[model samples]
Target: MVNAHQTFVIVGGGLAGAKAAQALRAEGFTGRVILIGDEPAPPYERPALSKKFLLGKEERESLFVHEPAWYARHEVELHLGQSVTELDRAARTLTLSDGTRVHYDKLLLATGAEPHRLDIPGTGLAGVYHLRRLTHAELLRGVLATLGRENGRLLIAGAGWIGLEVAAAAREYGAEVTVVEAAPSPLHQVLGPELGEVFTDLHREHGVLFHFGARLTEITGQDGMVLAALTDDGDEHPAHAVLSAIGAAPRTALAQSAGLAVLPTQRGGGIRTDAALRTSDPGIWACGDVAAAEHPLYGTHLRVEHWANALHSGPAAARSMLGREVVYDRVPYFFSDQYDLGMEYSGHAPPGSYDQVICRGDVARRTFVAFWLKEGRVLAGMNVNVWDVVEDIQRLIRTGRPVDTAALADPGTDLASLAAPAD
Candidate 1:
């Protein structure tokens, strides 16, 4: 019953959109596929923008999800640098920025997210930067090198993943780096105080300065160039450059304008969708950072902004679009690399959600598995410098069985064996 004349229009040219298109063709869908993006370049992975790519260890070409020729070979109509300005749900059409009307039998909104800009003065200064795009990374790579050579200082706002990774890269370049965070510790929101202290100590050992419990209030500049950053605590730090890495907001304007329901800001705002990634409009679907879909495991709508989410959810949404039964219950996952520490975190354990965080192996040596437990049941786990245990950790969380705390923390016990036997 596949309609050869059917057309599927996908908005946003990030990893999710690209993967969805790939999935459609892989699933033998003969329908027309049109992919549109605001960025001029084809769909690329965002993780490298803050890590290897920013450090100059990765090439620009390596960031793309697929080779440029792959799209043409797949017969996907690629439209770059043109944003869909209007979504007419009634007419089943999208009006691009260039005034071209594109009709679609099914619509996919993979419109990712944009970095949160600071409302403070001097954000538009020459040396003030944000790194949410490939072009931004390209610009920052050169700037960090110049600052390193001059022994210049980099004042970074927010100590999240992006800020910390950039600090690591800048230190590798021999640049003086200082981070300003409102939380008491770096990654305080994600890792909590105990584990967040590990990262704080790690960066300090690498010569990165931190000003905790304070945030940037203003950026002072001269001749439209950044000079220094003034913090809320009335402290001023001299800087040749400043990076605003507060966070990102999902791009949901198109969904909202089209009368699609979106989660409230408190619920990590994004277009609301069902377990199958189907939005309020039956003909439209959402995925990746833009889709706050109901997770079957959690029994709640959750929006995850990570590379893995986009990597898997894209294909999952594609299957749903093809009328396949889909329930997105993938465990939340993300990884980070800073200095010599490489860590992968699986499952959700935001602050109060976990009762205690237990560790296996050596914490001081930076080779350990930290598990967040609630009522003796594992909710999330993070392994630093440890490999090949993600499956066990995810399994523990999925089983929802309370584990023996001592056995769970003992390196001698096998994690897979800790889960209860199925009936």
Candidate 2:
């Protein structure tokens, strides 16, 4: 039971931390809520940094999770551009970057993740960049504008979500783009080879070039500015700017330093937590990308780095902190928009875990729902350019019943009817 007078401290001012603060107030916890963030600005939606914001379709102020006045109204202490440098778990206290120590009754670590940087040379060049924060996006936007003015090329060193989305935005800005990936196809790890080819075809049709199975050996620079990238095959790709989007590593230094147990590298490196989002410490919890939490449905620990996970997990963690015997069982969900394609995926299935993928609707037309099945059971499903079937798809996965492949692939079949009957 949480006492109304106690203090709750949330570290990390990203989506997860902001939502947790909102959840505490919404759940009637009249406690002192303090949120500490390293970023100079308040919590903001990061997904827009690559899409709408990068393309100049959305304004800067619109990216904030809540207006500055909301914090004052809610009586939540908002600390921006201040980092929690040390965590003294035994004393239930945290040391801030400014040498101020604050105590808390309960703590939630939602440190999120950091973008991975390439180890190759020339990464420090002026025209090289990585996208993970608002500032990075802002800087890249300016760089893209310059590229557009000069009609220069943008070389992206990865074909994952961030890379592809930025590629789309760069192309929209009139900058020629080329994407290089180590995998045989883009998004092969998540969507598998067949569906991955769909994205390849889409980008190719839009005049975006791809170098599959290619390794970026070096980035060539002159006068501290990026000029080109050299691959393992001795192919030199020219570019006015380079963007590294090879993915991110979870920000777990705070949790680890506080003596919290973290998952091993092989198991997905993140702070280890139970289904309730409780860490090894009884009074501490974790959520969002920083937590590698055990999932009841998948019988494995998953650390999802997506917007939906942060939105749902924060509330789940907050409820658990209030002693609500809650289980954070929401199915892992994520969406990506690239070019004319909008895709929503639900459920969790490791690569190669599914035996088959059933497609409903036309793949060539790029309007369809693809279901991954293991022994006739739906492991995961993705709707591409198809809207309003996510709830039905999630229901089918939760039912855990065998599904008919022919009926699943039939466009005439109603998705709502596919859910298995309650036991």
Candidate 3:
């Protein structure tokens, strides 16, 4: 049982930390809650930074997880722009960057992740940028605005989700966009080659250029400003500005320094946690992108960086902190918006785990639902330009029963009926 007077210290003021604080209050915990974030801004949504926010379709104020007034009303202490430099877990204390010491009865590490930096030369050039925060997005937005319509050449590194989304935004803004990806196809690792081709076609139709299976040998710049990117194939792609859309690495220095058990780098670098979101230490917990939590459904540890996982895992972590018998078994789900395409995916199946992909609807028209099946069992499902079926897809995965491919592919077959016992 948690004492009402004990202070709860939450590190990392991202969406997870903010949601945990909200959950603490909602769960009737009256203790002092101190949320620490290194950034100057309050906790805000990050997904939009690469999409609507970057394109200026969403306002800055709309990004916040909760308004400033909400924090004040909830009595949650906001420690903005201060980073915890030293965490003495045994002493139950934290030393901030400004030499302030804070004591906590319970600690939650929501350190999230940092954008993976490219070690290639010329990355420090003036027009070279990476997006991970609101400020980064703001800067990119400014660069895009200054470039005007078809006046700027934008070179993007990596074909991951972030890189692809930013490419869409840059192209939409009329910038000449070129994406260089190390993989053979954009999103091939996640969506598989066939489905991945759908996005490749979408981008090509929008005038976005792609260089697949290419390596970025170097970024060339003049007068400390980006000018072009050199590829291993001895080709140079000229650009006025560049954005590194390569993925992110989990921020686990705090947990590592504090003597917590973290997953090996090969297994996915993150603080190791059980199904309840509890770290190796009894008094400490970790969630969001920083936690590699075991999932009952998959029987494996997964560290998901999507928005939905952070939104749900934070609250579940808080409940577990209060000694509740909670299991963080929620199905992992993520969505992306690029060009005229909107896709939602649920479930976790490692690459090569699924034997076949069963599709419903029309793939040529780019309106369809694709299921990753292993031995006739649905391992995961993705809906593209399709609506009102995510719940059914998740249900099919949760049930863990072999599904009839014929029924699954039949457009007339109701999704809910697919979950029924095999006849």
For lDDT, the strongest prediction is: 1
Clash pairs (backbone) in predicted model 3 = none
- Please give the range of 10 consecutive residues that has the lowest summed lDDT in model 1: 1-10
- Winner on lDDT between 1 and 2 is 1
Q: Rate the local accuracy (lDDT) of all candidates.
A: 0.93, 0.92, 0.91
Per-residue alpha-carbon lDDT of model 3 for 206-267, expressed as tens digits?
Answer: 98899998888888988988889998888899999988888888999999998999998887
Give the alpha carbon lDDT tens digit for every residue of 1-423 in model 1: 335599998998999999999999999999899999999999999998888998889999999999999999999999999999999999999999999999999999999988999999888899999999999999999999999999999999999999999999999999999999999998887888879989988999999999999989999999999999999889999999999999999999999999999999898999999999999999999999999999987778999999999999999999999999998899999999999999999998888888998999999999999999999989999999999999999999999888899999999999889865666
Winner of 1 and 3 under TM-score: 1
30 Cα displacement, candidate 1 (Å): 0.1
TM-score of decoy 2? 0.98
- Residue 274 lDDT, candidate 2, scale 0-100: 98
